[model samples]
Target: MVDKPKFNTALHEKDGVNQPESFSASSIANITKLRRKQPTATELVQGILNGNKTALSRAITLVESTNPSHLEKATNVINQCLPHANKSVRIGITGVPGVGKSTFIEAFGKHLTGTGRKVAVLAVDPSSSMSHGSILGDKTRMEELVKDENAYIRPSASGDTLGGVARKTREAIILCEACGFDTIIIETVGVGQSETAVHSMVDFFLLLKIAGAGDELQGIKRGIMEMADLIVINKADGDNIKKAKLAKTEFNRALHLFPAKNSGWQPKVTTCSAINHDGIADVWQIVSEYFEMAKGNHYFNAKRAEQNSYWLTETINEQLKSSFYTREGIAPLLEQYKKAVQNNELSPFAAAQFLLEKYFSK
Candidate 1:
């Protein structure tokens, strides 16, 4: 004999009518007003200097925007913030997929925040080919760090950037520093050539690896390994601990084979368990030591100087290419030249020269 409890079906039913709540109109009007009132560059800079996260976020959005008006505003804001930037230590973290980069970042970020460091993580996510939108799932993955008061996490779409980083990541770093974050972590999308892009912009570049995966250097390129300032063998817990140690040993040996870095510092390999929060402190300690050594040798400032020059040249080249490609008569001419080249009617070099001459003639 079973007794059945009565269920209320009426409560689950919704009336075929729209309900309006108090303050709805006012809220809508206020949003409309706010949208109409774009803040000035001075106000945005002041908000950032005062550590207003909302202002920092909006400023970053402006920087990432392709709109001409937004670009002009973003440039103004960056110029105002430049004097307050460069106070933070920028660290780049990269590895192949399934290397637990998100987990490691959560643990490492918590450790830094526990020591009273204000940390900001800029995670670049792969863009969807069809939608051109970021997966934007890193915030969910780094749950612990996302909740920390001393931590700020921003996920950006990689867009068409070949390095698996957002085009405006360097500008985002400036915004983070202007907002008083002392440690900026740039997490790349773990794709080809991303490590190179990140290394150019960071003070320390870290590569995370795993163990028991056939060859110790399975998916990673040797050139990427050479760029790492610190190599960490993660997942060093339980059954994988011994394998992690062996991988660390192998990495150390391989690092020794590379030429010395310009900073005069030797790259180090260590092991850690991001899941268990083991050996995280050791990695931070190594970073601090490297900073001390590099600063003592004046390489820190010199590296930033070189990175600035590199970006300046890269920007000029990009603008020149953009201008050339977007000229009024270039698109149609380019299409014709492309067809001719594909049909073997014109050699590639001759087609290119023809296009250049046509472009210059205009």
Candidate 2:
């Protein structure tokens, strides 16, 4: 038999010309990725509807992008996904730093997924002042939940203001909901106005606190306390149980002082030791009761509608403010006006009005 030359694709060249298959695997992958076109908004929306986490993440990244070019695509994706959203129960969880927010969320999320619920956690991490990037080191705390097939943990940087991070997060919530997460938990950075912003966006606002953190009744953040639908005292295991019980009682009394919530459901307080998975079910029970009552009273849908309106206005305000400052000729004029105001050469309000008029004149 005549010997036929074996073709070694990696070793053989096309008449002294190299083909893509001749390149190393890593190089081929890199080149292929570079050559691939980005997915269309419709494609992303379809992927999200089909429960694709990767596509959901890419869409979220697009939503969070600062590039003006991405805004149009992001808006399109959000609009398409909106019809599939508003189905999940949004739970906002917040507390002061070191209050075991991450740990508690990890436990709570696992419990939820065990019940056959898909959980999406928008864990807003405090941004580094110098680098202004996500400090996701704490993501390790949710090691178990991170590996859970039904749970999605997204750690985002809390930008300079709640407007930036919260806005992107609100969009992310819609995407997660469309991607089949039945339970959406937004964990705030645990400081500043982030809690209030989160409270507005979620169906149930949960305030997680540690025992003996202060008066527990009045020393807490009053604004957020008023917004909370439930208060959970975490880390109640071992020697902390007694203190957690006392804090729970104090918080219950504190809730009584605030007028009944518009949801017509009285806020409840409970204690949990997240490390041991203690009392975790009780917390979910309280949340379930709240949902049951809200849905029965038809308040749930009404509240979401109100929130939608609020966010619409909020987005407009943020964009208008951004547009004003980012407009051409506004930066130099703003700087001059700022220096003038600092030197007492001009009134702040007058300068602001002039800047607005200048911006509008364009």
lDDT of each: 0.90, 0.86
Query: Model 1, 1-362: lDDT tens per residue?
Result: 89998687857875587767757888899999999998898999999999998899999999998665576789999999999999999999998889899999999999999999999999999997788987799999999899988899999999988878898898899999999999999999886564677888999999888999864866344788888999999999999999999988888888888899999999999999999999999999999999999999999999999999988887788667767887898999899989999999999999999888988888
Error of 2 at 285 (Å): 0.8
Q: Give the worst 10-residue stretch by lDDT in candidate 2.
A: 158-167
Question: RMSD (Cα, Å) of candidate 1?
Answer: 5.8
TM-score per prediction, in order, is 0.88, 0.88
